[model samples]
Target: MATQTYDVFQVIADPSRRQMLQLLSEDSLTINALASSFDMSRPAVSKHVKILHSAGFISIQDIGRERYCILNHDGFAEVQEWIDYFDAFWKSKLKKLEALLNEKTGSHKL
Candidate 1:
């Protein structure tokens, strides 16, 4: 069997990974610093970081002896674009509904 790969949504489904993103959004942190914030072992934290790295949500930098994790906007662009499409769809639907309601009530206030 082939090893399955996860997409951004699937990778971020884990609570730990979500929290890691939130932290990185505030400021870049070294691997050790990120590991300290979680109850899990350093290796476990590293795994989550790896997923985020692979998904393009975060970038790793080697600073001296430490590896720092920083937030990257490229991954979120996909999610944002998906949401924006639905936002426009809903806005159009709501406007049509409002027009229908106004026509029925014979009121232009709306």
Candidate 2:
């Protein structure tokens, strides 16, 4: 069977998945340990974990008999790049507005 692909944003769009990321942020966790934190069934949690893993947000490792989920930076880097672009865009616009306001008010305090 062919592997399925997932968009980073789409994978994180679900609240459960987002929470899973937050939980994993503190430390790596086994699949069962992670599932216990949620109200959903093990299969449901596993499904979300699979999506997160496929989207590059997480990596699963086999430690003896348990599978551990660890946070990965690859997916977050894409989101961060997008946010940084907008941050620069907004800063430029705000600087222009500040300059215009200073010119009109005859003050550069701001």
Candidate 3:
């Protein structure tokens, strides 16, 4: 049998990896550039990058001897799709809360 490959959930399991993605979402940065802002060492950041790379969350580009980390955000669709399943529940809860608040403050008239 062959091993199947998929790591959408594993990539987000680490807090550090999650933070790295959050930072990369705003803009692409070189490994050194990304590492400079954090208190952790470069090797540690590199390890996180390796994991992200394996998970297909980010890509690297070579530019004048420097490698830049680009956020490969296509993978996020799955995450959003998963979360949207609970949206209706949360929306209903918020609506109920709004109605209750309006009843108390006379602000819910609509």
Candidate 4:
């Protein structure tokens, strides 16, 4: 599979970045509006936005003098596909464990 993959871990690793994502998911916000929600400085918040932008998770749209941060959901699929890979493995393992437990305990509705 010749697919380009971005490091979702690197994008989501910071707590501040994670919070920024959560807010972005809920609504498109300007840099000032976003900074108000946290105690961090404007430059610090801008840095986080820059990382998210570089990671392709966000894009800025100019609305008059303000630039709104829009969530680029396409980038989210990177994480989703990775999780899907693990989900299949865990689901099968869980089913097998459940079957083994039932065998040991006997299939009685106690």
Candidate 5:
């Protein structure tokens, strides 16, 4: 079977998946452990985990018999980059507005 691809944003769009990421953020946990925190069935939880894994938000490691899920930075990096671009964009706009306001108000101090 071909490997499934997921968009990082789409994968994180689901509330369940977002919660899973939040839980994993605290520390690594087994699939079962992650599932226990949610009201969904184990299989349902596993499905979200699979999406998270495929989207690069998490890494699953086999420790003996249990599979542990750990948070990964790869997926978040894309989100952060996007946010940073907008952040700079907004800052530039605000600076221009500030300069205009200062010019109108005769206030040279920035």
Candidate 6:
């Protein structure tokens, strides 16, 4: 059987996964602790955690007997860069539009 790989967008598309990210954003949590917060079985939550881990969204570390889930910024870098690119793109276009509007209004004479 082939293993399934998910992109950042696809991995974050699920509400449960997004919620898991939100929770981890606040603090690191154990698998059992995270599972208890959701209305799902431990295995089910493990599946989501596994996906998040595989996508670099979360990191799992063993502290004695408990495993902790922590949020990782590396996974979000791509999303952030993409948004920043578009933000800059729109800002440049809007500035050009504003200049054109001011020119038409003769507001630059002052």
Best by lDDT: 6
The local distance difference test score of model 4 is 0.88
Better of 2 and 4 by lDDT: 2
lDDT of 5 by residue, 9-94 (tens): 78878899989899899999999999999999998898888889988899999999999999998876877888999999999999
All candidates: TM-score = 0.66, 0.66, 0.61, 0.63, 0.65, 0.69
lDDT of predicted model 3: 0.84
Lowest lDDT 10-mer window, candidate 5? 1-10
lDDT of 3 by residue, 1-110 (tens): 33345487777887888899999999999999999877899988988888788678898899899999999976666878778977977999999999888787885455
lDDT of 6 at 79: 82
Model 6: residues with Cα > 4 Å off, grouped in runs = 79-110
* Candidate 6 residue lDDT tens string, 1-110: 34689998899999999999999999999999999999998988999999999999999999989999999888878888999999999999999999998997896565
Residue-wise C-alpha lDDT for candidate 2, range 1-110, written one tens digit per residue:
34677787788789999999999999999999999999999999989998899888999999999889999988778778889999999999999999998797886454
Candidate 1 lDDT tens digits, 4-107: 46797898899999999999999999999999999999888988888888888999999889889999888879778889999999999999999999797886
What alpha-carbon RMSD in Å does predicted model 1 have with respect to the real structure? 5.7
lDDT of 4 at 94: 100
Task: Give all candidates' CA lDDT scores.
Answer: 0.89, 0.91, 0.84, 0.88, 0.89, 0.93
Candidate 2 residue 108 C-alpha distance from true site, Å: 35
How large is the C-alpha RMSD of every model relative to the true structure?
Answer: 5.7, 6.0, 8.8, 8.1, 5.6, 4.9
Q: Model 3, residue 59: what's the lDDT?
A: 89
TM-score of 5: 0.65
Off by over 4 Å in 5: 1-4, 79-110
| lDDT for residue 97 in candidate 4, whole number 0-100 | 100
What tens digits encode model 4's per-residue C-alpha lDDT throughout 1-110? 23344477878888999999999999999999999999989988988888788788999999999899999987767789889999999999999999998987796555
lDDT value, candidate 2, whole model: 0.91
Residue 94 lDDT (model 5): 100
